[model samples]
Structures are given as C-alpha cells and as structure tokens.
Target: MKKVNQFASSKHILALAAIAAGIALPPQAVMASQITHVVQQAGAVKGTVVDSKGEPIIGATIKVKGDAKNGTITDLDGNFTLNVKPGTEIEISYIGYKNQVVKAGSSPIKVMMQDDSQSLNEVVVVGFGTQKKVNLTGSVGLATSKDIESRPVGSAVQALQGVVPGLNIDTGNYGGDLNASKSISIRGTGTLDSNQSKGDPLILIDGMEGDLNAINPQDIESISVLKDAAASSIYGSRAPFGVILVTTKSGKAGRVQVNYNTNLRWNTPLNMPDMMNSHQYATFFDQAEFNGSGNHLYGDEERKKIWDYMTGASDVFVEEGSGGKWNYDHTYANIDWLNQYFKHNSFSQEHNASISGGSDKVTFYASGNYLSQGGFLRYGTDNSERFNFTGKINAKLSKYVTVGYNARWTRKNYSRPTTVTGDNFYSHVLRRARPVRAMYDPNGYLMSDINYIDAL
Candidate 1:
C-alpha cells in the first residue's frame, strides 16, 4: 500500500510539473508571436510627390489615412519616408494642387497631384460668412482691385462702370461739381416713384453705410455687386435697388511694404457754342426794331454808329436823355465771352500713398490720398480739393477669435465764382453776356457799368 501511494504521488507531481512548464512556455511564445506580428505589419513607405507636369513638389504634406497626427513633409527632392502599417492609405496635399491618396505597400509609391481649378473649392465672401463660389445660386459679380487699378478716376464708383453686366453707371454730371457721384442702377430703375430722393442702390463699405466715392480706389480690395433678390435680401428694406459690397485692402502677414501712386489728367471741352459777333448782333436788333415799329427805329444814324463802333471809327456815346453822358471806346475789342470765362483745358491730379505690414498676431494698414481738380472756368475760382485717410488694425486674440478696427476720415473743399449759383455760371450768366458790350473801358480797368458784360 505504501509503494502504491508513493507511485500515485510521483504521478501527481509529474502532472503538476507538466502543467507549470506549459504555462511558462505559452507566455513567452505568445509574447514573441505578438512582436513578430507587429513587426510584419509595420513598414517604411517611400515615395515622391510630383505635379501634373511631373515636377517635384517640395513641402508637400503626406499623412497616413485615419491617422491625421502622423504626417511628414516632402524634402527638397520631393521625397518622403513614413513608418506606417502595410496596406494603410496615405494622403498627399499641397497648395494649389489637388489631394491624392495611395495605399502603402512594399513597392515605392509615387503620388501625382493635379491642379485644382474648380470653383467649387473656391471660398467667397457671403453675408456673414464665407461660402464656396460654386454653391452660390444668386446673381453676384466680383471685381478685384487689380481689375480697376489701371483706371484713373477720382471716385471708386467710376471704376465700376462697364465692369459688370446688368449694372448701369452714369456719370453725366461728372466734373460739373466737386461732390458729384456717379449714378448707379442695377438692372434698370428699381422704382418708378419720380422722386429724386429714392431709387438709389445701397452702398456698404466694410459693413458700414458709406458713399462709394468716399473710399479711395487705391484702397479697394474687392467689390461684389448683389444683383438679385436672393443675394440682396439679407439687407432687408435697404436693398430694394441692389447692394454694393466694398471690401478695402488689409495688411497681410509678411514683410512691410510701401506703395505710392499718382495720376495726372487733362480735360478739354468737347463742344462750344458759336455766338453772334457785334455786327451780327446790331443787324439783328435793327431788323427786329424795324419790324416792331412801323418806322425805321435807328434809321441811318444808328446804323452808322454801330458800323463806326465796330470799325474803330468812333467811341460809343450815350446821349444825356438816355442815362448820362457815358463814353465807351470798344473799337479794337472783339472779345469772346466764352473764351474769356472758360479755359480750353483743365488739369487734375491725384496722389496716394500706403504703408502695410503684419505679423502672425497683428496687422496694420494706413493710407492717405490727395486729389486736386480744376474746372473749365477761368474767370471764377472753380476748383476742388480732397483729402482722405484710412487706418486699419487687426489682431488675433486666439486661434478661433479675432478683433479688428477701421477708421476713415475725408475732407473736401470746393470754390467757385461768387456769382455762380448751383453750377449755372456758364449756362446762365456767361452765355447771356451780350457781344456788343465791352469787358473793360478804355482805361483797361473793369467796366462795372457794362450791364450785359459785367458778369465777366
């Protein structure tokens, strides 16, 4: 019995030993298998990033699929090496180029990214946010600063003429007055109310109500015209005619830059009226007087007096019965009232300067402009001067928050003849001055008694 019992005990001990060995070997073997599996799944991916033209694209980003945190940039040779799992997908991207995806495998992967020119991906400014241009369904016209930079105009509104279809701009009174602005109408007249106070399109400059002429053309970055209701309805009652959105230039995060521009212009009248001279005037008056009165009013006496005055034969004399004994010698005078009062050509000049720069956290832009415009009038002081200044600063407070401030100041000065009323100096006062009247007496001093020509 003792022998049997000892055999049983030895068997039990052998079984226990076998079980222990199995447990110890399995843990080590399982660990080694897991390490081999991990090593086999991981591999080095080598590839080159090229453009559609097969040109190497340096600085292109390569990211493993489903692992945005793991990425590398292409080197100078457009080559990249990444440690990724086999059969994993990698995405490649670059600026102005389309994104591409390739599976990581044993073979060297070559990624070719094409240019993305589709408007669907292009971001455009909308009401309060940005949207893709392709997603827009309303009628919108965009004009960049480069589009109107070459135009030499005093007002920014003039630069928009003929730039966009369905937008009508009329500057019929341009140069007539200093503060005159171009009349803008989108898709024809919006209202039939004959009142001049209404029917003008709304102009918004950087989210504020402002005049289009108030902003300098040099400071304009972009102008978007919302022509349809779908695009303009955001402004509610203020946009019955249409909406003009003006965005000024902003400083970029880069090196500081200074820019200066000047424009010189000359203007000449397209047409001038032909007026009757002294002889023609005298003859017409004599005929009219004779027709009115049955007898010849001036007869030979008056006719001879007019001929002698024009031919420098005698000085004009008013008898004591008329007003007083006033002698006016206009013998050698054949003055052109129009030419004396109006200049043949007028001059205008505009100068602008700007300073812009920025860092990652803050940016600033400042600009100033001066414009001087001369009028067609020569006798009267007719001129205009304008000065404008603008400053803007933008700061990034956080990754998703930003703050900005913009301020603008404008001043305009206009001078015209004291006799001029409502821009009618030429049409009312100058044109009505009779040709027979003298601008100056024999002494060369201004003849204030010349009733018809005294305005000159």
Candidate 2:
C-alpha cells in the first residue's frame, strides 16, 4: 500500500511539472498568434485632404505617427487610403498648409487644413543667430528679393535706395557713370571722431565681406539692416555704425530650372547747362579783354585786326615783318563745341542666366551675368563691361551632417578718355570747355591752340 501511494505521488509531481512547462511554452506562441491576427485585422483608413477653402489638396502626404516607412501620398482626387491599427493617429501634411492629426475610426476622415502664415512672417537672421520676427526686440529692417527684382539696376545697393528709413544710400552721378557705386550710411553718422575715421556701415554678403556692387541683384535672396545697439552689438566693434546682412539665393529641391533675363536701358542727361553760342561768346571775350586792358594800349591797326577776327568777317591774318607773313584762316568759322562734346543718348544692356537643380541629397545653383554700360561722353572711349559668375553647392553627408560650398568671380573693365583725370570728366572738361573756339581748323586738322577750348 505504501509503495502504491509513493508511485501515485511521483506521477502527480511529474504531471504538475509537465503542465507548468506546457503553460510556459504556449504563452509565447499564443502571444505571437495574437499579434499576427491584429496585424491582419488592421483597418483601412480613407481620408481626403483640402484647404481652408475646401479645395482638394492633391499630393498631400498621409503618414503614421513616428513611422516614416509607412506613409502614402494622396491621389489626384485628394483621397488617401492607409492601413493602420484601430485608434492609430495619422498625420496629414501639405506644403503651405498646417499639419493635421486625426485618429483612425469607423468614419471616413475629412481634413481641412488652414494656410500656414507663420512661414510668411519668417525668421530673421541676427548677428549671433536667427530669431522669429515677432520675437525680435531690436530695430530691424527687412527687404526681400521681390522688392528689388523688378528694377533694372547694375548694383545691388541701388535697389535699396529709398526702401529703408534712416538708411541713406548715395549713388553719386548715376546718369552716365557706369562705375558709380552706392555709399550707405545708417541713421546719419555714427561717430564724430574725425581722427578715428568716420564709421561706415558694415556690409556682409553671405557672411563674407564683399562689395555691394559686386553682388548681382538677381542672386540676392534677402537683406536685413540691423540698426541700434541691441540689433548689432553681437558683432562687437564691427557693429558700431550698423550692419547690412545680405543673403544669396540657394538651390531648391525639385526639377531642374533655367532662367534667362535681359534688360536694355537708354540714358539721357537731365541737367546740362545751356551755354552761350560761339558768336555771343566771342563778343563776351572781346568785351572782357577791353575791360582788362585799356582799349588805348593797342594800336588802331591791332585793334581793328582783333575786332575783325572776333566778328568772323575775315579768314586771313597778316603780320608785319621784313617779309610780309600771313598766319591763320577761319572762314567757315562758327562751331558749337557743346554739341560735339556730349551724346544725345547712351544705351546699356544686361544679360543674366541661371540654372538651379537638386536631389534629396545634393543641390546646386549656377549663374552668369553680363553687363555693358555706355557713358555719356561723345568723344574718345567711355564705357564699362562686367562679367560675373556664381556657383553654390550643398550636400547632405549624413542625417545630421551637411556641407556647403560657394564661389563667386567678377571681372569689370572700365574705359574712359585718357585726357580725363580721375573721373573728373564732367566737372573739369564739360563745365570748363568753351564754345567760342572750333574743334577743328578749316583744313580738318585738330586745333592745338584755341584760348576758349584748348584743354580738349
């Protein structure tokens, strides 16, 4: 009886052990089966995306929260079907629209997205970093490409004229001078210490010190003027006056795009002094000479000769000597030097071409510009030609790593009459050139000695 009882006990212990092992083994299999069943039972969530106006937003993206691999794009009808677990949150997003999150349920989802105006407000670049426009506490002026794109100007600084308050841009003598560049000052003068050289506003082009004229207007993306201490202090001593930050255009991720722009301009002098004609000028000179030297000082013959010459009555001049000698002839005499010195109209041209393209990992932008400007001077050579090239590239080396490269080259050729000194053609030549003397003698040779117009 004891042996039988011990056998029964041993059998019971073995059964219990087997039962425990079976329970443990089946749990994993059961859990896996349940997961598979849940996956198989995933519901199809159908939804349509539209804008605030209720217009369909095609190509909108529908994605599962935190799951990049599981996403679908809406079709032409703005309808999307995504298979997701019940009660899963799906995100709907479209460019220029606010994102929407909705739960997957029995009912079909309709998402109406509002326009995202936050992007329009934009974040402004500061000396230290970037800040939202609303959060900026300093005095800042902003100008985008749209403000300057329509005007055909050679220098980027010219586009900013009259656009910003308290910012004085002086483009001295823009009419006929192709080499003219703008001088900028913020809030009048920053310092009165003449010994320390008056401070000029600091200009930065794409974070590099560069001439504003060298930058092509078409290549500009935006410009920010940092005024006052709070806006510019981060740059230390360099910001004592003010700061002008220029941002250049970068490539966008999309299909390749090509752009060509050309502009032709004609310039005319607006303020030319009306000078006396040759006859009137000769009379004035004769009167002046009479006033300076007493009329009685010269002999009657000499006085008659001078009057005849000034009156343009006789072409021949005879001087008394051992042998009778004749000097100059001015028969067909009257000449308008002003008409010959200045051009009625001057023409200039500009051509620009750009190509931009990008992929998910790489982007590139390249542009070239040619500009030809004609000066108003009619005599000799006066013109300028400029060539510019800019290239930019960006690469996403890794998830958190990005590299960028930019290069720009510019060549400018300016030509003017060698007789003119230091761009003083108008001030020295035109203003002083007199109309009494003829540019050429009767024989068509250039006259070397003429009292009124000898400088030419």
Candidate 3:
C-alpha cells in the first residue's frame, strides 16, 4: 500500500510537469477538443431550391430547424444564403410544394421540392364558414378578384355578368343610364309575388348585409354564390332565393405595401333607333289615314313642303318661340333629335388606393375608391359620383384566438333632369322628341320645357 500511494503521487507530478512543459493532452481530451472545434463550425450556408422538374422555385422559405425567427426567403433566382451552424438541419417550405429538411454543410446545397397534392385543394366560403370545395355538398360558384379586376365596369354586378350560372342581373328598364337600377335574381323568380318576394338573393359582404354595387371590385378577394337551398340553409328565410358571399382582402404579415390604380373609359350606346325624316313621316301617315278613313291627315301642299324641306331644297329657318314655348312647322323641319340630344360617348374614370402591412401579432388594411361617371346626355345635368372606403384590422390575442374589426362606408350621388310624373327619362325623350320637330327657334330660343328632353 505505501508503494502504490508513492507511485500515484509520482504519476500526478509527472502529468503536471508534462502539462506545464506544453505536452499534448491524453486521447479523451483530444477527442473533446475535436468535438468543440466541430461545434464552432458556424457560417453562411448557401442553397438553391428547385421543383421536381428542376425548375427554380422562387420565394421558397428556408428556416433553421425549430427556429422560426432565423429564416430567409429565396430570391428571384431561387437562391438563399442563411447564417447557420454547419451540419445543422434546415426546413425548406413553399406553398403547393412538399416540405424538405436537409443538413447544412460547407458545400452548397440543392433542395428538390415535390408537389403537395393536399395544398392544391381549393377553399370556398359557405354560409356557415369556409370549407374545401371537394367536401362541399351544396352548389356553390366561386369568382376570385382576378376574374373581375380587369373588367372596366362600374358595379360589381356588372363585373359578375355571365360569370356565374343562374345569377341573373338586369339593368331594369333604364338601360345605358349611369345610375340605372339593377334587378338581381338568383336562379329564377320562383314566386309570383314580385312586390313582396322579388326573388332578390341575399348579398352579404364580410358577413354583413351590403349592396353588391357599393363594394369596390379591387377590394374583393372572392365571391361565393350559394345557389341551392342546402348551401343557404344557415341564413334561414332571408336566403330563400339564394345568397352571395363576398370576402374582402386582408393584410398579411409582411412589409408595408401601397398600391394605386386608375382607369379612364368611354361608354357608347349600342342600340339607337333610326328614325325617318319629315317627308317619309308625312307620306306614311297620310297614306295610312287615307286608307283607314278615305281621307288624308296631311294635304298635298304639306306633303310637298315636307319633301322639299327634307331634301335640302329649302333653307329658310322659320321658328317662333320664347324660351321653350316655340311652335315650328313640323312639315318643313327634318331633324334628328336623338343625335342632337345624346353624346357619342360618355366619359368615366375610377381611382383606387390601398395600403396594407403588419407584424405577426397584428395586421391592418385600408382602401379608398372614387368614381366619376358621365351620362349620355349632351347638355343636361346628368352624371354620377361614387366613393368607397374600407378598413380592417386583426390581432392575435392567444394561440387559438383572434379578434378583428372591419368597417366600410359608401356614398353615391346622381344628378339628372326630372321628367314628368309617371314618365321616365328614356320613354319621355322618345315620345316627346320627334324627328319632324326643331329643338331651337329662329330666334335661338329653346323649343321644349324642362320636363321634356327636347329642351337640350
């Protein structure tokens, strides 16, 4: 025992003297030092993300395993450089593609992303909530903002024309009017009572009742048309005809973005009547009257005067009037009232601006829109102006809970000449203004009243 203790003391003294002389450590210490050197191997790791077909995948996310904050996105060339430890695992992910985890190395890495079929499933908004399109049993039609954003239309209904089956939209009697009333019907008119149940479908914008025309087309994200009863069962009788669900755009967690868009358009009437001159009108009516009662409505002298005046043989401008109370020789005046009162094309313009951005905890979006639409009239006060503003904000309060607020305001102003009672502008213009009459007298005074369109 005394010899063993003396041997251990001599070995300890020898090891301390070797360390003080800068001798190499034992095998276990050398192994530990090698491990420490490997762990300190941290630097920028470069990688390229590509699809199965070898095409570079732009905007792919490259994140460190278990570290969401330490991530980077692929640039336009599908290349990314992230500062991470060598041999560490990184997660590569992108929408419509499967996720991949690969070990980082000193050498460049190339990740091949396969297609994720589950990510291709389409999601649609329903009466209750959102559901996958394949899982929905009821009939629903979808229209994304891409379907209507490029259309030069003033109303959302106009943009949606012919986009969805069974969705009928009619511009109700006042065709071509800038502020014409629209009659919307889902499927068809099931009930005969047009007064109470006009077969108008229920339109909801972001879960609230709203006019389809009031919402800006640029602000729409998607439009879901609930056609069948099963699809609209959640809304009860309010959706008896059907329902239109409009989802608006929301902000995402990213850098702040501002967008502005504007468009100028001209609207031309397609269907205008071709009327006969005074000579043709007088001849046809005179012949009809003579054939009916064996007597002529216009004498031979009047007929000759109409024929001469309409043929440009007579240029004598003869008219008597003060203000719009003029009486001119109808048989001697051959005028085109429709062409004189209506313009060739009406001018319209729309402007939209929006700003959206947020952090992961809170997101916000706001937009404003303005539209100025001119009428078809040439001289009268006829035009329309519209304004729309929308704002939305959402905050994540907990892991599984989120709170949101949304507000929208819309205003429309229309101006036009008032017609007589029970008479609309179109019908009144067509009935009162004749091709055989004059819109102005020899004294340059108007030849029609304010209620009539001939005054224009």
Candidate 4:
C-alpha cells in the first residue's frame, strides 16, 4: 500500500513539471530538429543572364569571388546557379556585360543579368573554348542544326559536309567488308600510320572524344569547326586534319515541351534513254550478227527473214530458192525489257518524337526516331531501317553538389551493294533479246561480260 501511494505521488509531480516546461519553451524549440534545420537552411542563386531584349547570352562567365576554382559558364539558356559557402560573394561578368556582385542567404536568389556592353552576336565557342567574338583570336565556323537535318546519315561528320570548308568526307570502298561506312577527313591532309592522306577530322563532343552520328541532330544545339592550323593547334597530334566540336541539346527551365517532326518523300527516275522498239530491235540484232566479230549463229536466209520483219515488213523471206510460209517477226517481249526491271517511283518516310521539361531541382530530356527508306536501284535493294534514342537527367543535390547522366543507343540496317552488281542486270533489262531467248547457251552463259568494258 505504501509503495503504490509513493508511485502515484511521483507521477503527478512529473506531469506538473512537463506542463511547466512546455509552456516556458519557445515555439521553435518545441518543433522537430529537421523542421528547424530546414527553416535556417541557405537557398540557391539562379538567374538567366540575357541581353536587353531577353535573349540568353549562352557561354557567358560566372564566378565565385576570389575563387578561380569556383566558376562556371552559362549554358545556352543563360542560366546558372552558384552554391557559395552560405554567405560567399559572387561576381558575374561577361566580355560585354557589366559585372555584378551579390551575397547569398538561406533562400535561393534570382537575378536577371542584363547586358549592354557586348554586341549580341559577338560571342561563340572557339577552339580554346567558349569565348566572346571580340575576344576570339582563332578561325572558327559556326553551323546551325537546321541547315543539315534533311539527310539521314550514319555519322556526324557526314552531316557537316559543305558547311565547314576544308573538311573532306568520303565513304571509301568498304575496304574488305561491304557493310563498312564512309571515312571522315578534315582539310584533306595528313598521312600518319597510313600511306594514304585520307585522315579523318578530330571530333570533340562537349570537349570530349565522341562520334557525331551517335547524337540525334534534333538534340544538337550547334557545331563549331576549327579549320585553320593555328586555330586547331590545341588538338596537337590529332589536329593535323583539323577539329570539329559539336554541342548537344540541353533542357530549358519552363513548362515541358512536346515536339513532333514528320516528313515523307518520293524519288522519281529521270534521264533514261529511249530504247528501240520490237522492229528496230530485230534489225539491230541482225546487224549485230552480220558485222559482229564472232561467227554468225544463223544463215543468210534467216538473216533476211529477220531483217524484213524489223523494217516493218516482217515477212518470212526464205531465200529466192526456198519455198514455205517462212516469215520471221520480232517478238514483243524483247522491246520493253528496260521498263520491266526498274521501278518508276519509290518512297521514304521519317518520324520523330521528343519530350523535355524541368523543375527547380531537376531537368530531363528524351527523344526517339524511326525511319524507313527505299532505294532507286533496279533490283529492290537500297532499302534502309533505323531506330535511335537519347535521354538525359540533371539533379541538383545541394548548393555545391550535382549529379547528371546521359545515354544514347541506336540500331540500323541499310542496303547498298545493288549498284556494283553490274552487267547481268543491264543485259537482262537493256538487251534486245526476247523472253524466249535462253539466258545461257551450251558453253557458259552466252552474254559477254561487261566488267572489263568500264575498266579501260
């Protein structure tokens, strides 16, 4: 009984102490540690550095005060975030823009950087890297993505044709394999590790080694080529042929964008020569036999009969001595050979889809393409099939740490050996022979091989 009474009295005293402490404690002190820490946290610094008209000044300069190591260049969007020590000072400057300095607090800071000092067109990426046009000391050529997006090629270098001067591009014979793609050459110079001077250009993506074709053209923001030896010297041994720098597309801060691009095309044959008709064909073949270097396959009587038929007077002429209803007339099958083998029209189709968006803490981008194309060859060859995808995501973890990842994958199939297939196709379609005519006579196929003709 004594022990129970003692416990009840102690419990009542503890309850009264708790009530007093709660009433005396500060409202914030009563809250959880996590909520209080969050309230006192430092925010981020963000802004779109732009021209007076609101155009983003991509590749501009931004830095933390007194810290060369703590600096970053503005992206195409002219947006940047500097997570300085909770209260570090930042200096924002560009070649033509007035410099600005500001201090950070627990909340994110937004600044709309305006410029009047540098002309809008006076800045671009050069060999040494992002620089102002007025500050450029090297030769550089900037190419737009819209100019060369029409062609569907397997490599990025091929897309740059004619856009950049001095860069030579060609798809040499598939060396030993027919499936090999073309080779890329810059400036048409260099003969190292090769007896040939067809060295390819040095391709750089985001200042790193990469293939251009692997990137989706829609995802490309721009391309810069360093052609002059002086401008390309930074590439050292790899720059003998010159260098090509490609910048890929990036996410923009705003509502998500959904884009769709569609295209369809038809190829029509042209410039084909007129072929002889049934009668003309018979006459030509008769002459071929009479004046041909090889022994004649038919007698004079047979020749006369065939010649008469070709002159639009195809009456069987059995020499004056022979008598019978013997009249030779050319067959219809022999005249329309060419049209039977080649098609008059073919079609091609391309489809593309893309989605991009971002939030305050993260940004994402993704795209895909599907293509089906047919060729202009006689045989149903040259068809192509392809599929490609690319995606990327950027997440900001803190004021100083960020994580990002990007990936691309592609699969393609194409037909190209049809052109080199040669004479068999030509003879079957262009030869003045009737369908009844045998493709091969006793001794190996009778048609003369045309391979040696183009040789000389």
lDDT of 3 at 139: 89
Q: Return whichever of 3 and 4 wins on TM-score.
A: 3
Give the residue spans of candidate 2 off by over 4 A: 1-120, 172-176, 191-196, 286-334, 423-432, 450-456
| Per-residue accuracy of model 1 over 1-456 as CA lDDT, tens digit each | 566556545545654565577733233223322222233234777788888889977667788877899877775446677788788989998888778889888988888898887856656566665576778888788777987788987788888888878888776544455556678888987777747655777888898889987778899998888888865569888887888888899998999999999989998876588777666766786688888885654456656666677788987623222355234432224456777777899999999999999999999999999999998877757888989999999999999999999999999888876565454665666656666666766556676765435555
lDDT of 2 at 121: 73
- Tell me the spans in candidate 1 whose CA falls farther than 4 Å from its real position: 1-124, 130-133, 172-175, 284-333, 423-428, 451-456
Clashes of each: 0, 0, 0, 11
Best by lDDT: 3
Give me the runs in candidate 4 sitting further than 4 Å from their true place: 1-123, 149-159, 171-183, 188-197, 269-338, 377-382, 397-402, 415-456
Give per-residue CA lDDT, model 3, range 1-456, as digits (tens): 566556545545655676789875454333322222233234988878889999977667788999999887774346777878898999999887889999999998999998886633778999788998868888888888999898989989899999988888888766767777677888877679887768888899999998898888989999999999885568998988888999999999999999999999988889888877777877887899999999988798777766777777876434345565444544267778777777889999999999999999999999999999998877768899999999999999999999999999899999887752125645776665556665566666675443353445
TM-score of 3: 0.70
Q: Score candidate 4 by TM-score against the native.
A: 0.53
Write out the backbone clash pairs for model 2. Answer: none
Q: How close is candidate 2 to the true structure, as a TM-score?
A: 0.64
Error of 3 at 364 (Å): 0.6
Worst 10 residues of 3 by lDDT: 32-41
Task: Quote each prediction's TM-score.
Answer: 0.66, 0.64, 0.70, 0.53
Per-residue CA lDDT of model 4 for 96-137, tens digit only, reads 567777776556554556555445455566666587656666
Candidates' RMSD to native: 21.2, 21.6, 19.1, 25.0
